[model samples]
Target: MKWEKLGLVCTADRFGVDVPTRVMVPTPVFVNEDTIRVFVTVCDKDNIGRPYYVDVDARDPRKVLRLSERPVMDVGTAPSFDEHGVVVAQVLKTRDGKLQMYYSGFERFRDVRYKIFTGLATSSNNGESFQRVKTTPILGGSDYESTFRCAPFVIEFEDRFSMWYVAGSSWETIRGKQVPRYSLKYLESPDGIEWPVEGRSCMELQHDEHGFGRPWIEIDEHGTYHLYYSIRVCSLAAYRLGYATSEDGLNWVRKDAEMGLEPTPGSFDSNGLSYSAIIEAHGSTYCFYNGNDFGREGFAVSKLIK
Candidate 1:
């Protein structure tokens, strides 16, 4: 219910890439009992993103262990769904012992600002490298979700795979700039690869909220779902963390006031907080999140206190 902030862990400079200016989205997964590999995306000078990772000490995540030498995978060639770039969202180990990486693929368009879709890659030899399952997005555009269908967080069950992702068909102009309007949607796939054309509506935008970022679901011992996501506040031109609870993972009860996480004034996350992911290691619950301007100051961690 509350958290103790751990400040910034690692940034783009740690990778020693002159082209990358910012590190975005911290998707942390435990490689072992002592190592936490934080999968992230680094943006080039033109703002195109590529997925990389930073390994940190599980006991003290502020201590960086290693930085990935190259991107997990390269951007797609021209005319592909991920021709522009990719941002890693979540990585899960398959029943067959391979790593399944789900990410958001970025594509630029002249009509709108951009289009984002979900893509998948697989790493057979641990998390060192990956190969795209296909050139096109596994969850691409549909009639209902025409513009965006990205930021996917999936949980694989024995019988099915359940996903909570951001989806929308429209864009709105706010503050004289075009912005995509999206909300949470749910889908069920027999396998992690194939999915339906459209997803069942879960959470819709309310009040000044224009979009929802990544959906991170945590199931308690009793099987109650706690969904944590970021709301794109149109009026403020920034993001704020949102929380909700669900019994069946389809319907949700909004409880933003109880989220207990907020921006730290005069700090890296002073203006905006976005792209949050939760993981439990060594009996401690940790939340990894991004800061202002989509993590220009890199990602940080917070330990759950209550």
Candidate 2:
């Protein structure tokens, strides 16, 4: 697949936030035929993230329609699983007409530097506010993943939910900071909730890979699975978009060379591009993603170069 780069869409300052911060992971939620609401992770000066939403025209996604006055979901209390930050990974509408949000709860640790766990929230009102179902994490993988089980993307088919998330498999000490090593994993649930404690490995880690940022999937008309994610290398210290395809969701192959997206040498996204969110709307395909500085530089879009 090919993409046409579009520049930055939203900055935290537009939301009345301070400078030197970022707005990352702009995932689109279709509000209607003409409008789309992009949910984003807004980083604070402290480098903590909170989920926020902004409305944009579907015909021209860069135009701002509205912005959330406050965070749709905030960080948890002290000593809580998400005390440090909460990054919005996926939001899906259940069969019962409620929206379910799967997020990565951030926790800072002295031993490991940080740990991320999966958590859930539900929205009764369209796409406005959400309430946490519980404080405890919904995902508990192996000890390797004890430090991270995040970036969950779920697709419900036949009334059953299938999830693809990034799970840490190792930790590497890099220049005084603990960086995690992870790969893509999969799980199935009879309901949107109640997944097994562990997930089956989908995308294995490559020798040159440290971890993936987010895994996004979409079933094409031909029933082939399209997976888009970010590849992080410890040496690069930044992310670049990658892609894969599968006949069965369980088995996969990487096609990063075909992803056709990279940072522009002297652009806002030049530092890095990660946390990709793709949507098919208004007769076109567009991808929203985070740029350099982990979105401190803000979010941008890329149109399918069809």
Residue-by-residue lDDT tens digits, candidate 2, 1-306 = 778887788877887766538888777877788988888888878888888899988998888899998889789988888999888998887767788889999898776668888999999886799899888788854554667788899998886889999887568866666689888888898976687877788778787678898888889999999988998866777888998899998798889988888889988887788988899887899999988877877788889976
Q: In candidate 1, residue 128 scores what lDDT?
A: 91
User: What stretches of model 2 exceed 4 Å from their correct place?
Assistant: 141-144
In terms of TM-score, the best-performing candidate is 1
TM-score of each: 0.98, 0.95
Model 1 pairs whose backbones collide: 1-306
Q: For residues 1-306, what per-residue lDDT tens digits would candidate 1 score against the true structure?
A: 899999999877777667677898899887888999999999988888998989999988888999899998888899988888899989988888888999999999898778999999999877898899988999999888988999999998989999999999998988998889998999999998999999999998999989998989999999999999999999999998889999999999999988878999999999999988888988888889998998887899999989
For each candidate, the alpha-carbon lDDT, in order, equals: 0.90, 0.84
Deviation (Å) of 115 in candidate 2: 1.0
Question: Once model 2 is optimally superposed onto the true structure by TM-score, how far is the C-alpha of residue 126 displaced, in angstroms?
Answer: 1.7
